[model samples]
Target: MVTPAGTLALLHTSPVHVPVFDGLRDRYHPGLVLRHLVDEELLRRARSSGSDAVAGPVAAALAAAVADGADAVLCTCSTIGGTAERQAGALGVPVLRVDRPMAAEAARYRRVVVVAALRSTLEPTVSLIAEESGPEPSFVSTVVVEGAWELFEAGDRDGYLDAVAASVDRAPLSEDSVVVLAQASMADAVERMSTRRPVLASPRLGLAAAAEAVAASAAVRAGRD
Candidate 1:
């Protein structure tokens, strides 16, 4: 009998990520079961008060996802993603931040340009990339896609993507600098970029990592049985 793919849950700060990750699952991990949970308020609170404000809630969400049959949980909110990943040991499951894979790849270069639409996302992303880069990591610069978040919040997705793409074009990138798009929503901006530079985004890369994690965990469970 074929071993079934384990279920993966995605925690999102905005509802828009639901379709994006779902599309990724369909494209790559067709057999993987997926559950999506969104809490717009978690991000809202983190942006206002700080990431600590949502630490407890992020933990609760991860636990709830596990209890609900998720073998792995992927947090899609860049703002509070670090807090969520820290709960992985307590959850005893793979709780991953979506930016992590992209961060790991971005950290390889001598210079990196991280682009985000919100100030709240910028710091967490930089921290994640820095951790991946180690002590002597690359020189990382940040670019905020000004006026883009408002467009996203206003449901102007096309405009928001265009703005993100425009920011990449305007960024001061050297030939060696790899560009990292800080949010999953910014993935499409890569295709929209005119600059011939390597751009990394979270959605596809993150989901692939999550799928690998699920497969690894499942193999272990199967071994035990």
Candidate 2:
């Protein structure tokens, strides 16, 4: 059996995506090869409304990984996510952004609330999901505590969840509403806060999709060889 290989070029802006990818690796196992690459500063700058200037470097790094033999690329960060698609085209391989799946799902509802970890993730995620769903759902966004990253670095899991959940719970969601986690790291909280509405996580969806893409690519390569 030829062990398959895939790389999760995580544009890890924060520590949250680490656990998200870990969950994916645990669930998918040997069938889906996986790893992560972190570029912390780029993510922070991108989340702060920095232009594709930051994304360019991150994409270049990912492009290098693909050149290095990664069969597929999975980007787990929400902000600067649009870069993934562009990188995918440039690399000529499967590249998936964390928001794509949840965006598709969230679009099915009439109204949606996105609990993004950062302001930069909110609009892009909502817009992408809206484009897919057609009837463009109403959108709302809320930022958790400003220093949520500090709390995370301090190993305050409870504090991190509390701040995120609180921000999400307070958002003005529609009466008939759907909720989506803008960032992959927010998956756990999505499950915990799935009260009164549906909560979707991007990392879970992106990873599953990426696993399939990598598997398909490997199968095709083997057939040709």
Candidate 3:
């Protein structure tokens, strides 16, 4: 089915993301339409050969969404976030990284703990944090939850969350540190984690940002008309 003209299309790399994003969209932007396009291979390719390997395909997906009448596109995979942002101008609509708002929030802290299931997400997420933090000096540390992705791949979501939580628990986190969940899939694990530090998750913040972008685009078009 063709999505409505004002639809917010989410480009995802995991099938499990549909319900999570849909729930967020329903709660935050119920009036707006929603669509999801999953490309599992994109993440796999990114993990194996780096984001450059999936940049072209990701750009194509964005272009297709725009052509299909998406008002805004949310790249829900951090692995391809840089590529999505690079192609945003050409897409003629907002193409936002899902971790953007979380990164921005993370930048406010003097120190940040970035937790991820995959190594591929570290660079883009840290770069986003730095970009948002801008000129201000901040300390950032990365913790990759070993074998967490394997659990996720095996459909053992509970195991995945437990592993992530365990990894965070073992890290030398303090009350002053801000913990950033580097991947959207890892967002739920934060709640399970016991930490005094503030935890940042992407889904709600990112979707809210995308909703505002869609509204802004519509306003601009209405003004032109």
Alpha-carbon local distance difference test for all models: 0.89, 0.70, 0.87
Q: Candidate 3 lDDT, tens digit per residue, 105-204?
A: 8888899999999988999999889989967756999999999999999999999999998888888987679889899998888778887678888998
The whole-model C-alpha lDDT of candidate 3 against the native structure comes to: 0.87
TM-score for all models, in order of appearance: 0.95, 0.85, 0.94
Model 1 Cα displacement at 16 (Å)?
A: 0.7
- The true-versus-predicted C-alpha distance at residue 123 of model 3, in Å, is 1.1
Between 1 and 3, whose lDDT is larger? 1
Find the candidate with the highest lDDT and give its number: 1
Count the clashes in each prediction: 0, 0, 0
Give me the candidate number with maximum TM-score: 1
Once all C-alphas are superposed, what RMSD does model 3 give against the true structure?
A: 3.0
Candidate 3 lDDT score at position 167: 88
Cα-based lDDT at residue 74, candidate 1 = 93
TM-score result, candidate 2: 0.85
Q: Mind giving the per-residue lDDT tens digits that candidate 1 earns over 1-225? A: 122589999999999999998888887888889899999999899999999999899999899999887888999888988899999999888999999999999999999998989999989999888889877789989888889999999999999999999999988889889999998889987888899889999998898888988888777767888
Q: Which regions in candidate 2 have their CA more than 4 angstroms from the true location?
A: 1-9, 135-150, 153-155, 172-175
Model 2: colliding residue pairs: none
